[model samples]
Target chain A: MADYILGVDGGGTGCRATIADTSGKVLGTGQAGPANIMTDMDTSVVNILSATDAALLAANLPVHSYSRITACLGLAGANVSGVAAQLQQALPFANSSVVSDGIIALQGAIGDADGVVVILGTGSVYISRRNNSVTMKGGWGFKVSDLGGGARLGQKLIEESLLVHDGIYKRTPLSSALLKHFDNEPHAIVRFAHDARPNDFGQFAPLVFEYAAQNDPLADKILKQSVETIEAALDASMHDDQPVLSLIGGLGALYGPRLSVRYQPRLRTPQADALTGAVALAAKLYTQTAQS
Target chain B: MADYILGVDGGGTGCRATIADTSGKVLGTGQAGPANIMTDMDTSVVNILSATDAALLAANLPVHSYSRITACLGLAGANVSGVAAQLQQALPFANSSVVSDGIIALQGAIGDADGVVVILGTGSVYISRRNNSVTMKGGWGFKVSDLGGGARLGQKLIEESLLVHDGIYKRTPLSSALLKHFDNEPHAIVRFAHDARPNDFGQFAPLVFEYAAQNDPLADKILKQSVETIEAALDASMHDDQPVLSLIGGLGALYGPRLSVRYQPRLRTPQADALTGAVALAAKLYTQTAQS
Candidate 1:
């Protein structure tokens, strides 16, 4: 049996690792650079290794202690990458397995209990767990869907900015600021959007919330539409039994208060972060198998 | 001086040619293959030449007659390609120049008269002409702004279908039909959307209309949003003098009756097609230069 358990939460923006005793007691944690395996597996591998090393060092464990660890990694973009299955071979840990970053978030939020978790960051994902059965919905990515995610909000703002330029929509305070970024050229907006990745689109989402605070009509309109998407996702995710619901991610708290009235009562603060979820999962997976 | 004026309208889907007498009398017309200069200038040149050859044949003129013709071409994607300026050197015409396809659309709908023409085909372009001056709005292309264009309508429907799959939106008659296109796999929808071009998205737009005819709630919702976009574009295009308004393109007549009541009084059927407008410009340009 492994002497220690390692948990990894890898995402497009960053990578995190947590080390613990076999029983799941906290030991140490560390974070590293972007680890989106789908776009760049080599980079993800390097960052994941660095994150694990940092966690080991922080725990005052020997450099070769990784040989005694059992790891379960939750990584973003795992589905599209054929390289993910081979990731275990490349890792320093004794045993490692890969799952989606969303799963880690789900475990962190609801923990083995039956409930639902909605992550609203650059992308959006809704996952529900009932009777230990899990199902995922939404999070189809930015172009076709992201719904309440920041990337979609930012893209929607750019789309609306063009409408303002075309005289289809009335101008608001945010219009000038948004236009200034594109140099008042609608073609520039189109060009930027043409090659922009989801992260690029997400960069402008904060501007909408800022302008909405000032009572800008266009901003208000955009936020309202976004809030509705969040509400809709919640409606689909929650059941008649009313499972415990938690919103997690950069925009999670931001969207909480603005959600429809019915969702307010059901919304609960997440008990832990994805890294914590990853570590917990690592402990459970290894301990159960080790005993058996 | 050139004895004949040739007008060419080149688009993403097809190329058209018109040959007329110097006095603006129509002599003959021809059609050929796809000619979007932005994506494929070489193709556009080939199709334009073929269209010209066919028009000359229909007019009972020799192939060499192209040397005696002056042409003005309105082409799709003229703005994006520097090759547009050099098109005169590649063409069979004696004197030639290039302009946006939208300009030809405007001239085709209103002729020398002042009015606004909204082209609502696979994509959308809105142009207004007044006091012999012209200004264009919208039609920034898909992914950013097409407003009420069919590509946008279709893309919007696909996005909605995913929402239905996510349980965010309820299943309707249209939902099953849409999911079938992707083999009922949400990830397939994501993959298809990642690489889908504007024309690809446009293909699904007709489905929205088909389901709307049956009173499918999702279809009705999608169409209503699309109509609002079209109406918004119209409001921006219209002026106090209330110049004639024409909706021209594949979905033009379909959207005509669905327009807000306020626009009904101002709406007028287009007088001609883009090919006719091109020939008229060719005649005017050469005849004026000849007199000077």
Candidate 2:
């Protein structure tokens, strides 16, 4: 009975949904608020539904036409145990599957082909698909992991600035500027960090890259460290028979060139965005279920 | 008139009070729960009072005799802008001085002499005294600073374990043991870290040392990193005319031997504990006030 495929990409900041036909023709797109399931499942579900309703309305479909849609949701925090199952159970659709945001990103970047996608957004994750199997590295979250992500880069910047404050590290213009951003008050930075989310820390990441571009020693050091970590993660995710690698997300382009030349030729542009991949997956699921 | 001097060392874990006469002869001691001023000022004050009252009772003095005590409180979180002044105003005593826990630890370790005390407990701070002036390095806090503290060491351990899980870092008994402790579920570790306090992370520190002693490569790497950071902090705190260096706190002895041999000859045994240093400060304050 499904007439349309719905692709949803949900994260801590916001949610986006797209409506497409089986032939992959886009019908409409919509957006809503944060939908990170682990933090607030009810809110995430609500946001997902709201985005889907908007997409359906934009497609000139009735609000009650959800039963004719097969949805594939790729969400941040969906990898947490019980989240995907709970989300699948809660969704109001003809057929739906919930997966991690990274998976959709990988699929969107490379389509049905076997390749790798390195997501370098507020957080980081390296996901690779081979044949029909997929594996991942990193993206373990912030403070403990997400080594080369924007949040980690910003966090290290704050730490180095404090070290400069304590005379443990040589002060630089980059560090001085970072300290000035905090009003030169270490306690204020501490207070801010205590309750900071990943995005809050990620806000400082662009400054790091900007300073590094000017050959600021401290900024260069931080970027080098981050690059090394990302390289290690990419290396770990690689297999002998691996396909092309695509860098994705906000910091993807910034990090791309900084990576070693060995990885340059292996990098490929993503064929489509995550929402397109989500719809592609929805279409595949609809066809398979119909045959079954 | 005040007849006795009181020294109080308060931290995030617990509070300790020592009662002494003007000559620094220890009379009695008492203990109570955490008294970190910034986190909970009212509880800190209450715990400080409770510990002082118990110390008085143990010294065979009446609890009502608090007005006769000149108290010195060396408290964690007192370095924050208004914590010391706020705590001083809230005290119930003949006179009181509130200084950082690191200051009292340095004073207790070397008496009136000049020296540096490197505190390596649940948190870290390097305090140095030269003549009548004092300076500090490191000990900004955990996750931002506190580089070589137990919390940082444990945090590194968890990070390595996750890397091992991701195959980015090689597996070792140390990493395996840590992963097992978390039920082999990465999500469990993430959940624990989401709400973890410094002490919670510090709880895993001993295992890192234990594994290093057994020659676990991953453990050795973490320790080396921590030692390097600590050495940097120690070097930064050292002045041209710096006095003896004393290592203090729970992991002090463990880290002492691991430090570079060049710094070994500079280390000295503490003359007394932080509580004793606190009492000495109280006595000194009382004398200065009386002379004025």
Candidate 3:
């Protein structure tokens, strides 16, 4: 029987590792670089190991203690065909299973209760759980998907700012502020965006919400359009038999109040985070297996 | 007097060089890689020389003949502050002047006559000349600008296709066709977009126009929205006096017919390509100086 359990929460921004005892008591936590498997499977795998090693060290366990651990890894892009299975085979843990990042975030947010989670950070993912069956939408990544995501919002902000710069669109406080941030040079913003990652774009997301509150027309358009995408996703997942709903992530709070009135009453704060959910799942899966 | 004249047209897609004698007869022409100064000035400079050397070779002129060549380079991003001056200092020529790509295209289109040119390719730029004064709009680069250009159109196609895949958007022929191109896997598209350059996305542009002609709803929306941006840019650049307007570049022909009725009467064909404009300007500026 394994002596401990390991949980990994990985996404576009970073990877996190949690080590806990069989009784579900947390030991230590650690973090590492980006671990979106679809972006780079090899890089994700490397980051996972690095985070796990850091967690083990924090727990005062030897690196080889991975042999005594059963792990549950919740990874971004785990929904892609064969990615989870491939990762399963590659891990050094004694026994481990892989699940989507959305699954863990849902698990973390609602615990054992049936519910839905709209994660709106650097990337966006919509996940619902009813009677333990989970449905996931979006969270594809920054390139083409992740509608209503921070990266997309930030991207639009910059794009619109340039339009304002060219007088093609009327200038607003948001565009004015963004132009100033880039030193009033559209080309400077262009240079920043050319090599920027999703999180880099995400940094500008809060400004959209901040400006929208001030009645910035451009910001209102950008945010409302994003909200429309989010509502559409929610419309598909929030069924007739309503489940508890939670909004979670870096931009989650900002987006929560912006959701349509139909969803306002259903919204609840998450009980915990994806890392916590990962740790709980690891303990339950491994300790139960040991007992059986 | 310079032994030969060189004309260089550089943009995001590639650069072209032409070598001719003082009498305005083109001796040879050559092409090289992308030379958008905003994107990468060093790369642009390198491509300019590579294309020039090939043109010189074709004209039976030594590479060292650059030292005695009076040249004019019409370059994308030349309007960016200090870029043109920096480039002028860096070029190996007897005498040279730098102008925005729009300027050369304007010269090439109307031959010192009053007119406007809308270049719609992997990128977009609006340029108009009236009474020897030039007005340029857009053409800032793909990351934050290029609203109606091929790259932006293709990007929207992929983004919408993913929405279709998620069932948030109704499927259309255009989305279906694009999904098929990416092997019906949204992840493949996400992968493709992660590292896709502007021209890479531009490759799918013609397909949008093709599908739009069939009344594919998504394609129509995408095309119409792009047309709106084009019209807006034109509205800013096209004056009340109504100068001759020529739509040029890879997608220009497709965009021309779709323009609003207001621009239809003013539409005309480009007299020559950007390279030809560069050559004519080179010959005019240098020959005029030599004669005087």
Best by TM-score: 2
TM-score of 2: 0.96
- How much is the lDDT of residue A273 in candidate 3? 94
Kept native contacts, as fractions per model, are 0.87, 0.75, 0.79
Ranking by TM-score: 2, 3, 1
User: Model 1: clashing residue pairs?
Assistant: none
Best by DockQ: 2
- Residue-level lDDT of model 1, residues A188-222, one tens digit each, is 78778878988898999889888988998988898
Worst 10 residues of 2 chain B by lDDT: B234-243
Error of 2 at A171 (Å): 1.1
lDDT of each: 0.84, 0.88, 0.86
Q: Tell me the interface RMSD of every candidate, in Å.
A: 1.9, 1.3, 1.5
Report the lDDT tens digits of candidate 3 across residue range B39-78: 5788888999999999988988777578779899998778
Cα lDDT, model 2, residue B178: 100
Docking class of 1: medium
